[model samples]
Target chain A: MKKLLLAAALSALATGAAWADTVRLGTEGAYPPYNFINDKGEVDGFERELGDEICKRAALDCTWVTNEWDSIIPNLVSSNYDAIIAGMSVTAERDEVIDFTNEYIPPSPSGYVGLAGGSVDVAKGIIAAQINTIQAGHVASSGATLVEFASPDETVAAVKNGEADAVLADKDFLAPIVAESGGMLAFIADDVSIGGGVALGLRESDGELKAKMNTAIDAMKADGTLNTMLVKWFKDAAPQW
Target chain B: MFEICAEPRSLEGLTWLSCYLTTPKHAAMYYSILTVLGLLLAVVPPILFLGFAGALARRSKIAPVRWLGVGYTSIVRGVPDIVFFLFFPIALDQAVEYIRHKIKCADVLEPVYQGNDFVVCQAAKMPLGIADQFYHEAWGFSLAVITFAIVFGAFTANTLHGALNAVPKGQLETARAFGMSERQTFWRVHMPQMWVYALPGLSNLWMILIKATPLLFLLGVKDIVYWAKELGGMKTQVYTYAHPDWRIWYFGALLVFYLFLTWVSQRAFDRIFARASRGLSVAS
Candidate 1:
């Protein structure tokens, strides 16, 4: 009688755990054309749609949450969210800290886009970038102040203020900045590029959930949903997975 | 590399005229910095006042008031201000929602944090999930400004408190002997003298504030740093305006701008300092 009662209690606990179906999704709304808040104040863009599809495919109720680009990783580790669909590149270094889905998006090169103006000869010593960034690493390795700004707006603002010689950004993101910045900048050379593409991030402990996501993503790619979403957002610039 | 032209050439004389100073967007970023300046200038004073309150509370006579003040000041100081800067806006955002959540989503049976997500009913959404882009930006900016004030206010309080105390004890005693009330002494005798002592500390705080302005990026506010990173990246030949390797130039421009601002501020502070010290004859 005691053994039977103990088994009954264990079964109840397992049933309670199995009934949970909610999932939390994270994104860096800062990255546009991937995931950004629309004028409607709703999360929109390719990653946003893709995240929704994944939840639909997995049959889990999901909610979208936005976080800053810098703190997204730390927040993920703390279980601030269950999954991250931000335009996070799956770098080898980052892989050591968190497991990722098979590259949801393939490698895309990032480079600085500046207004056309006076040529700067920074080949031997000078590399273009703000005081912080992977690009800044290029300058710091060579030992320099590495120009710094507070935001994308300020970076372009520097050119308008005649305070900065150029600005750095992803090659794909330049068009919008150029359009919005009121001609303060134009295209610089695309010689130097940073190779990485956004991927879905998951905590390593959630192997079960990660496997589920991978399957859903694979199905999306197979069914042409991924391509369709990319074209809707990126037009011709949408990268292949 | 450092050579200069005798006259800043017009579009006619310069060889790279089309390449330089020609993009329509480039012309607009100039005015944008004014907006950035406006944000900094408009937001800082209120923060100072807030800091003053926090500091004064810590020095209060009532134990509870003193404890509250101590808590505010210490909480602001203990964590890295960056963490506070990032966390406060989101936490405050959630707090606003949570309050709304209780009123609008009173029926939510499950906990707010289920595993990792914070879910509130539609009625409880802060800014109502359907607000305009401008409203969201404004809300975000206001939150950033408040965070700035809360964090910096504590430091300002510490400075102001010390300044308030540094007024010689004899001055307070003399005021009392003259039959002036404590309030009157604080306003006339102490308040007036406190600035002279506070000037040095306040000026230092101001410099720190200037340095701290860059962290606005972390707050999700679209400040100048955001634009720099946006415009400084490399672009291909397909782009409207094409050049080669210009991020160093963009960043160099920023360095000069900050240096100029700092230099001008130093000059202004010097004038204020001299005026504040005018009536004193104490030996160094």
Candidate 2:
């Protein structure tokens, strides 16, 4: 009876773990087009549709979890979730901590958006980017003062408030904001590409799960479905898969 | 709002402002303040009850109960409270779902410890797999509350234990001389008298609880802080309302909100202490 009880308890813990089929896909639901919380408050956007297709083809039970952008990668390392589908680009600094599957969305250009007549000097003027993002890296190296904010909205806000002379972010992301600025803001510089294109980040140890997801992602890339999504959401800014 | 919002770009000054504040997301931010208030009101009663149990257990003659109570109180003090706040919800959620998964899917032969992932059966998912948005939010909120109650309960227990000791020995002896049993003496004499002593510490605990509501953001709940960040940032042309970086303004509003809450709390605690101390001697 004691041995049986011990076995049951151990199996109970094993049973509770992902030893089952479901994979929890973690994303920051704050970014638009890539991923955002919709009016119904569910995760919606390009990645949502694309991630669903990957799960469908890969034959894995996938669930969506939204985590804060700043801690998304660390949370995956700590086993809070299995994968990060957040709009994170592949960067050398991050590669030290987590592994990437493959380039799903090819690296697109990043641009600087500033007040229409008050362009940031780029050499010395303060520039803002969302915290831990690749654009922040480019700003850090470009001889401009770098300011970081927790969310993309705040980065744009920094430019509007004069806290930042300009905000460096994905061109596609800043395009709509500039259009909405109604002549208040405009692109101040040429598009500068940074990092490899965005990819799914997994724990370094999650090789099997990574293999499964990569297969699904590669399949998406093969049939032009990936480009279809890129065009639908990113329009002219999308790079061909 | 209907009129001012019509030509968002054309309007300026306070007219533009009126429409901006009335955006649907701003309304959600306002409602989130009430959510924080609701959490405060809901968690306190249970915390007090837990404290009462802990104090009694500590005072009990039984050796293990006293040790258990002592352990509960002392252990929480050495570790930072915020650690508990951060750790509890995720751990508890997994633990709860884990238990449910075991019973619901007994025949499953595979191990659950897949790397970096914790997968459970579909039916065992909390709020179930297809729960509404409200259910999901409420479930997360509930986990946050329980985490707060448990962590704060330990602090409250320590305070109540000290308060229990502060009650005069003469009062207990007098109650016993008047034919009161141990249980009766506790209920009739010790518990009532201890309140005057406990009120000051409990009030301090209450303030900490009030200030700590901001930590709900860490638990992934869309509390006031989350909404403030979401709604205050500049909205571009695509949004119905657009603005420049207004974070300083939004955060200023939040600072005032918390200040008002703390001010009211201080006044109410002062009144509570005054009433509780009504008949006690000045020295006592």
RMSD of each: 12.8, 5.8
Q: In order, how many clashes per candidate?
A: 53, 7
For model 1 chain A, give the 10-residue run with minimal summed lDDT.
A12-21
Question: Candidate 2: how large is its RMSD?
Answer: 5.8
Candidate 2 is graded, for docking, as acceptable
Q: How many backbone clashes does candidate 1 have?
A: 53
DockQ of each: 0.05, 0.23
Task: Give fnat, all candidates.
Answer: 0.00, 0.24
Across A28-56, the per-residue lDDT of candidate 2 in tens digits comes to: 87777688764334677889998899899
lDDT of 2: 0.81
Error of 1 at A211 (Å): 17
Instruction: Indicate the docking level reached by candidate 1.
Output: incorrect
Tens-digit lDDT string for candidate 1 (A67-94): 6655677667645566889767666777
Query: Best by DockQ, which number?
Result: 2
Across B193-278, the per-residue lDDT of candidate 2 in tens digits comes to 88888988998999889888988888777789887776666654434455555777888999998889989999998888788777
